[model samples]
Target: MAQLAAARQGTHSTKTRAEVSGGGRKPYKQKGTGRARQGSIRAPQFTGGGVVHGPKPRDYSQRTPKKMKAGALRGALSDRAREGRIHVVSELVTGDVPSTKKAMAVISALSLEGKVLLVVGREETTSWLSLRNVPNTHVLSPDQLNTYDVLVSDQVLFTKAALETFTAGAPTGKSVKAVAAESEVEA
Candidate 1:
C-alpha cells in the first residue's frame, strides 16, 4: 500500500481567504450591519470566496527502507513465478522505432493476456517503444521494476538481458550465471 500511495500525484490545491485576491477592504461595517460579521469578501460564506478546510497540494510520497522494498519486490515476483505467470523471453528484438504489429505478434506468440509488464535492460529503447502502443502492456527497465507493477500485472515478461540484470545479487537463490545460461539455451 505504501508504494501505491506514494505513486499518487497529490496535485490538489485550494485557496484560503488570505491567499485570495481583492479582499483587502472589509465587506461590511463591523457594528452597523445586521448581517453576520465577515472580514473580507473572500470569506468562505461568499459565493466566490476561497475554500475552507479544502485540500492542499502535498507530497504523498513515503520513504520505505531499502531492504523492505527489496523484500516486497522479491515476494511479489516469487508469487508470480509460483503461479506460473512469469515468462522469460530469449530476446525482445524490435526495429529502430515503435512497431505495434511486432508487439502484437510477440504477445500472441506468448499467449499473454490482461496486463503485461515487460522488463528490459538499459538503453533498450527500440523494444520499449515497440511495446508502447500495445494496449495493457507497460515497459520498464530493471531498475524501474516495483512490487506494485509486478503484483498488478497478469503476466511479467522479462527479456534475457533484463532477467539477468534484475536477478543479479537478488536473494532468489538463482545465480546470474544460471539465468544467463538458460537464456542462452533459449536464444
Candidate 2:
C-alpha cells in the first residue's frame, strides 16, 4: 500500500514520468528517404514525435481500491486532525447570494486564520458570492476536490453534510478519490 500522504502534514506524492505519456518508438529510418533520418514513427519531429506514447488525454486516474480511497481519505483527515488543521461544522449556512460577512463570521467562529479551502457536499451560489472575494478562501464540492486545492489551502473545513457525502456516493454526493496533496497549478 502506498503511504498515505497528507498535504497538511508535509507528505505529498507527485506523478512519476510513467504517469505522463509520450515515448513509444523510434521516428524515421536512418536510410535515404529524402527526409531527415528518423528512428520510429513516434518521433517528436513528426506531428507527434519519437516520444514513447506522450501524455494522452486518457484517465490520469490512479487505481486506489475502494478501501484505499477510504483509507487515504481517513489518513488525510487524520493528518489534519492531528495538526488541528480541520474545522468541521454542522452546516455552512450563507445568505441567498452568500454574504461575505457571514462567511467571514464562520471563519471567525472557527478561528480559521490563513488560507483555507472550505469543502461542502455541494457548492452554493451564496457561499460562492461570500467567499469568492477572499484572497485565499475558496469553496468546493466533493467532486471538485483535488490534491492541489487541498494542499494550497492551509485548512479544510468539511461540513457534516459534505463529510457524509464524501464517505458515501449518494444521489447528491460525489467522490474525491484523488490524492489531496497538490497545488492548483495545472500539470
Candidate 3:
C-alpha cells in the first residue's frame, strides 16, 4: 500500500495568500473609512484569492516491511476470489493467428464485463496479442500480476497454464542453470 501510494502522482497544489499574485501592498488604510479595515487583496475572504487550508504537493508514502507488501498482494487475491470475480480457462483459440474477434467472442461467452485482467503464460504470445486489443482489457503474463492491477480490475481471468505457474510462487534468485540442473540428476 505504501508503494502504491507513493507511485501516485501528487501534483495537487493550492497557493497560500502570500503566494498569490497581485498582492503587492495594503488594499486600503487602517483607520480611513467607516467600514472595516483591509489588508491584502489576495486574502482568503476576497474573490480570486488563494485558497485557505487547501491541498498541497507532498509525498504520501511510508516505509513498509517486505512481508507486508507480500501480504497485501495475498489479501487482494483473496478478496477477488471471495467476490467470485476470478475465472479460469483451459486455453484461448485465436486459430493459427492472433484474432481480436475471437478474443471478444470468448469474453462475451464468459459474460465478463468492465475492465478485465487477463493472465496467460509467457509462452502464449498469440493469446496475449489477441486479447490486448479488446476494449477495457489488459493482458499480462502470470509473472507480471501485481496487487495494483488485481485490485483495480473488475474481473480476473487466468489461463490454466498461467494459473498453475502463478500458484507455484514467485521465482527466487536461482538461475536457469541451477533450475535445469535440479530437473536433471547425476547418474
What's the TM-score of every candidate structure?
A: 0.75, 0.51, 0.63
lDDT of 1 by residue, 59-138 (tens): 88888777677777767776777677888876676557767677678778989889999998877777877777777988
Candidate numbers sorted by lDDT from highest down: 1, 3, 2
TM-score of 2: 0.51
Across 50-114, the per-residue lDDT of candidate 2 in tens digits comes to 34444333333345565565555656655665676877777666446557777778888888878
RMSD of each: 5.4, 11.6, 7.2
lDDT per residue as tens, model 3, 58-135: 888888765666666667777777787888887876456988777778878999989999989998887978887677
Instruction: Go through the candidates in order and give each one's C-alpha lDDT.
Output: 0.77, 0.60, 0.76
**Candidate achieving higher TM-score, 1 or 2:** 1
Model 1: ten consecutive residues of lowest lDDT: 176-185
> Which structure among the candidates has the greatest lDDT?
1
Runs off by more than 4 Å, candidate 3: 1-9, 59-65, 75-90, 94-96, 104-116, 135-137, 147-155, 173-187
In order, how many clashes per candidate?
0, 31, 0
